[model samples]
Target: MAVAAAFTLPLVVPARAAAPAQAAEVAAKPGSPSPAFKTVGLRTQLNWMQAMPDTMPLAQMSIPGTHETMAFYGTAFAEAQEFKESPQKSLTMQLDAGIRALDIRVHPQGGVDGDRLHIWHGAADQKAELGSGVLGPLRDWLGKHPSETVLMNLSVEGTVDPSYCPGQDTASCMSGYFKEYVGPGKQYASLFWAPSVQGSSRAETPTLDKARGKVVLNVYRNSAGNPYSGWGLNYGTDAGYKAQVQDEYKVGTPSAITTKWNQVQAFLATTRTKRAGNLPYYNFLSGTGIPFLTPSDVAGGGSTGSGDPTDPPTYFTGVNERALGFLRTDSGERTGVMMMDYPGYGLIDEIIRHNPTSRAGTAVEQNGQLNAFVRASDGNLVRSYLPYDAQGTQGPWVQETVGATLKAPKMAGNPVATVRNDKTVDVFYRSDEGHLIEAWRPPGGTWQYADFSTSGYAPATIAGDPAVVNHNGVIRVFSRNPANNHLMESVLPTQGSTAGRWEKWDHADVTGAPQIFSSATAVVRQDKTVDVIYRTADNRVNHSYLAPGSSWKQELIPTEPPKGEGKLGEVAGDLSVVAQGSTISVFSRDAATNHLTESLLTGGVWVHTDVTAETNAPELSGSPVAALRSDNTLDVYYRSKDGHLIEAWLNSGSGTWQQFDFSNPVYHYAPPQIAGDPAIAIRPGKVSVFTQSGTGSHLTESWLTTSTWTNWDMTADNRAPVLG
Candidate 1:
């Protein structure tokens, strides 16, 4: 219920989330960390996220974060953290105790340098600089322990420099100042997840693999509407990146402590029941109400039962004490992020305990097997499977051919493969006369083919290769229409009378979309929306999404109005769209430059990039094939101008474009003999591309093994029919 609930408050501290900082601002620093601080994480928890896989997200874990982390220097009412005199050092101690998120409020002095800024607990200046006092130490800690990631909930405290008061637009001003320490050659340049925050972060949540060794952001944007272009994940106000927070700081009086504690308990209960989502949850246990309840009164319990007979008694338990008791007594899972004032007295320990010690691997490994298909010179469809290899020897892959010899139909042009949701492998291609020829093989079943174009299933004909996707056992194949160049859809149902037929030719998505000049590329989004990307006759890239229970919506790339200078180049070759988690990427070739191009879709918007321009990759020939590795690496493979198969890859480690030319002669990996285009199938540790051999009628497969690329001729090795 994080983002699902309404964002009914302000964006910053003045609202419910940050208003607690404004409560009881009487200046007075607190004592050192509680006696319980030294008892937590004696040898463990220092690098807790280290044990978690990169695939795991902080949203899924229960983290302990400090509210007004550097607030220990201010007065008792203003302070949020413990260990005065050197609160920055206390930060290191908290990090050691499994505290991952920091609610850091900075008082911007409005200068070019970060040191001019100071940490503030409301109006009280904590006397801490933003640079060496805050980020500098965090950078050093992450550098030493690259596996551990820190989440900084950055915000503006009381006021900013008179020279640059952003007023309600503090998000922009804060991000602008942060730019000085990031980007090329800066100290904390690579300290944050660049890609996650690049576009509208609402598209998805940040996974640990993308956040480790850096400071993840929970930016407090005090503005109207969604803070789409700012830093960190939004509070799920208008989007789904929910950071549900409960910071009810106004504990009216010390006697009202139970009320404050109830908010903490309620937030935990609500978020835990709804914890199935992939959004970070915040539960603030720090609060103070000016004249009645101070910071100390709210966290460590205030005195009760008046000796002066005027009032008989005022009974309440400190929020932290209540939290420890409730969390210790209850065995509920997922406490989310426990943002606290004084996170000691075994409170931090209890919160950290909710995190999973070990999680099962979550990659979508397809039965640990690779499957591919190719067209033979005899026009027969040949399917290959790497099921523990031919002799099941040492993972060294071998081919198993199934085709015409087994009643598979003859086809024209290249054959494309699809792994349906039912785990069945199906390949489709066009007949010489543009008929729909489909071949399907069930798990451990014999190969089969049906000419749907003439079987009363589909009446339309395909002019080129097809893009196939199976959503929930419903197969949809989109191909260019031979007559008018419009992409046509042929559906195969898993049930009812249409189960065996490739029927349903007129899909609302295709019919509503404009005519396309090339084969359509389609991918199903995480939300089950089928997004088909194609190039119009005018050469501009376009997208059409089919959301359930709604009409098909089509628009040009970037957006309808096209906000920025960003635009997808004129596509000249076949487009390939791939869906990685919540991200959809369409790969194409720039018409004028023939450079491998990519248009990434996130937050319902597109951002274009020329791979050749970004990486200086050699100009590509024909079309490009793209596949995302099991390790989150995106690879774009294409035929280079020099007749070598080129691979351009992008991963977080390098954070840049890198390449490999298989036929460079230096790697000693022979190419597939300079083929037209390729089909890629990726499993756990390897990426395999099926291509047509230039010599003879061989269907060759090229794959990588550790440091070497291996190219094999399936036609010759398995005595299979020749490829066209």
Candidate 2:
């Protein structure tokens, strides 16, 4: 298809013998190394020729008005390690496999005057005899083949120039001659085109495709446009010349590269793809807390509260554990919570009280049922049986065997769940698709999991944050639905089977819109009726009752006093409802300030009270857990804004609030669940509270005994534990 030269370089070629005789003694000396080819005195000129297979037919192709050599050297000779060791002795030659010779006459001055380099391939030594100024033959040869390689030597014929000399003896003049050779096809052919007189520098392409690994052409330029030429070889063809320049040398990445040069530059861009992986990274701030723990610790501690002296408010102490999970029981047995500690990472060093001999289950996502507790076990705590269920039941929790371990789908973030118990224990969790799911350990049987909503009903929109409640014998799951601007709930059988049906109730009809509503908070009252309390968008506490079998009844827990108490009342988002007898009490931080507000259902109506007024108002979040104290009063615990757990309670059934200085302030106090609800039997009287600690390590619990708060402790199981 195309006409070009084929150059198969000789393994060891001898230079022209006659021209080197004058410097033969110098050449005979130990050849230090062949001098690297330079571009100072080199020049290039292209020519055309008829295609030929071998050197049996060659034509003389020399530039007109130029006596300089275009010494073509392959990358092999130029980059050979041996070239470095012996630059003076190494022979630099290009193959002439496809050049043919032509019979020509030689003049004394040795001038073959022509219009252009001849491009006619006939024999390796083909030449035409002509006097110094015959240009017609050269033009005829050029017309024949317009594309071919034509190299020549640079030097005067008979003697060296003297008058315009740059100061050189005979040695320099004698070493000026070089041989010319045409190249092969696109792959095995390349040239060292130098545009200079001193042979000091030049650009080169590899002789073979394999020799050139990945070529990246970066054309550096000033105001004159691209300064680098001969960059087309990087793209394997001339089609990429302009593209290669625009990509590497241009200011911005243009939408399209229009020229062959640019395409070549784009081809070269592959070379820069891997440089990003070679940079350094900072190692200091990446690990656990190396900086200050909190602002107060860094700024020299200052008092945060000005409550009373006998019962001063304190900040939360940090409580965290790892490799521990929370578990509950069917008899509602102390809502049995268990966890395991690896013991290596500050396990025994902290106030962790669980035995070291426990077998932990896997840490799975949305797998709140990984609950293994130290029940009334016949064996040691280490041998405590973990309850799982193959079928739904009300007692003796059994493991659900599945093809693979239960895990949250890949894209979900920190999938978690909490278990609540009535007749049977059920785990309520938010699925990866943002729908509530209930997996139950049926009484005396295996576990069964089901989606909370039916397909034909209203679509369920579950919030990532969810809470569950076991009321009387019914298990209720609560979640926020942003679609309809309301909190939603689904209920299940609380006494026997694990299967449950979800019933959706609009908060608007339940709480009445225009009156803002808070997120969902449900409590299984002592009377077995469900009391769901929440804050309206207007920051008022609203209550909805699912009384026995009756329809949902909604009412606003009035915070406005009987027109006498000069203080104003407000309700916050984290609403909590607890029923003690007919007096259902709702707790939440006041909207006006970070203070706790209590609404008591008295005389078939709700009444409001501020427990923080007697003591100083402490910051609180989430719903506070309430437990009937040994004194028959209500003790409430919650987290404050300063990141500490605090407690305040009614001293008596008469509604007189009193603050107590329990134990050290805990760092983070999640919504806590009281173990001794009036419905359960083995009532410890002592309030056990479960919450995630500030360290974010594991769940921790604190117990109140004999009117005093005790140190926090993690369970024996290693999975992260949570309270429902």
Candidate 3:
């Protein structure tokens, strides 16, 4: 007759009614984090642990046409509903890997109670052995006592005969075979399993099984013990065993090794054929009349074979992949998607990996149409093709059209800049004829495009970074009008009778053309106020602000006073502004003395201070970038004259800039483009900076958190699409 089994066993009462209080406690504790579980004092533990050869680790047990192996080492818990419920209980062992051969034993509060349980070679075959190799007479007693939780475990064992190699020289990573039995020459064996359950598990093993398997778990190897050797043991519940050793592992003589090797040597002497990383081990846990069975699942496909559990360190740990563009935003659903997509389709799921942040907005691709396919800061595929003919309407994100023919622009190309509000987003780019065009999203619809192209306005060429912001429920767009040397601001209403239409244009009270005079930067503060920093034609940094609904308030902040009134040549100033409460702090790199100065707004009064001495008193020339941390601390990332990324932070609530060198700066990359326009964003504990790399257009992003600084060079210079 053919026999079958279930996934888990039935909970049975061995004697009296099982207590409910203990079960309730166990259920409650499951919700909270606990230490790793450990099993001890099982009468069977001492005997079964002793019965198994110390040198040979049971790793893989196989059936016909299939081989199942343990993926990692899980905690062995001694479970009981209550202390008085059943003293004669046994624990069951379940494996994440496939089950093949099982070694079972019974420990009667005193008498011998164990069974080999049932054995099978395939799905259809079963062999029940009750007398030899496992179960004794007490096996029947174990079956009658259902309340006893069995301490069941599987010991996967393998056979490693030197003949398998036959004098081969080349061995695979994590797997080494003896070419020929030499004198006292040493051989390496590998035992891999999970060290902890919470983190990703990795391991390495060898096999003649042809198919390479996934890295094994709980990597264990025997070595000549050294006192300084790093020996890590991870066990217990999730909150349980946590041990760390730094630079503890060092090479030493065989005699200096620990006793674990001696125990391994003794086991090897008697059980040379049964080495670690071989055959699988299975244990019998009490179950319904039908037991829960685990079949053989190999790491790699093919004949389930095993390898040396003792391998070198290089084969186990290293950088595997890179994470990028972690952004947060509101989603139509709860737990909105946190995207990490790049221009190269190198998108990875980062949803909820870290706690969500309220300050950042979700990133989405503008749309699959035109150049709109770029990924947003938030990480969603923003299809901006939605129809937003009416204001207050937003569109849905649709999938890209497969094999669809893409059309070029109707006339000339239009250069545009886009920004998103709470729910709506708008873009305004220069069209073919130098006229500005607008596209925006309404309340609940897609983006609608409009050409606000006008006739000849002026002969002046507009040149400067355009600024966009959502203030007081009104969307505003500003750009420099080089003709009249003025800052032009346009209002796009979010809740208007004609939602997608713009109200009218207003002129800001600040202006300067780079080619004609000095440099300037305009930024909108969090308080719905506008602040602009510029270098006057006299070579000094100056600051000005646009009040809620008033004119600009200009303040002069000088590094080195000009000898005369007007200065020659274009004086460039690298300026950045961030708002803290109602005040705005503007930092600028002065052109004359190559120093940094700051201007602050306190209770409507502007205070100018020379902050260069606090920033390491270093020479500066290029543009500086800044981002606000959760602590409300402003971290400034900048490029030195030598073209390396440097950092400075306002240590105290007061605006005192303290220079702090970045840990992992691009020290060796030649011709570093740190001087280029630097961009920064602060989210949670992480701050990311995007800058050009070594005079190349490829953007290299470096991230800094409390722990470490990581960098990833965007895409290679090759424009070809990455082939899968």
Stretches of model 3 off by over 4 angstroms after superposition: 1-419, 427-461, 494-500, 503-520, 523-527, 535-546, 549-571, 653-655, 661-675, 717-724
| TM-score of candidate 1 to 2 decimals | 0.47
Q: Over 4 Å off in model 1, which ranges?
A: 1-367, 389-402, 406-408, 494-502, 507-511, 548-551, 558-561, 706-708, 719-721
Ordered from best to worst TM-score, the candidate numbers read: 1, 2, 3
* Cα lDDT of model 1 by residue, 1-724, tens digit: 0000000111111100000011111212222233223233332345545434344567877888887787776566886665734756777777876788888777667444746566777778776777777888888778877767787776666545546644646556656666566545566667766644443343356766667788876664432223445456745554443337777778877667888888888888888667356677788888888877777678766566674788665445577767765654443446888887776735675576455322110011235565555555455565555556467554434444555576655554456556666666677777655677777777778677777777755545665566667655678777766455566777877889868566655543445666676666676755666777777766677787778667667876742226322445455556777665566767887654567766666555455666676677877655677766656677777766544667888754645667777767666454423546655666656766655543443556677766567877666777344544
Query: Which candidate has the top score in TM-score?
Result: 1
Local error of candidate 3 at 85, Å? 99
Which should have the higher lDDT, number 1 or number 3?
A: 1
Off by over 4 Å in 2: 1-404, 408-422, 453-458, 467-472, 493-501, 507-517, 524-528, 548-550, 563-568, 621-623, 629-631, 653-655, 661-682, 705-709, 715-724
In TM-score terms, candidate 2 sits at: 0.40
Question: What's the TM-score of every candidate structure?
Answer: 0.47, 0.40, 0.38
Predict model 1's lDDT versus the native: 0.61
Give model 3's TM-score versus the native structure: 0.38
Task: Report the number of clashing residue pairs per model.
Answer: 13, 111, 86
Worst 10 residues of 1 by lDDT: 1-10
RMSD of each: 23.6, 35.1, 28.1
List model 3 lDDT by residue over 167-246, tens digit each. 64212200221111111231101111222111222222222121111112222221111111111122222222111111
lDDT order of candidates, best first? 1, 2, 3
lDDT of 2 at 42: 19
Tell me which of candidates 2 and 3 scores higher on TM-score: 2
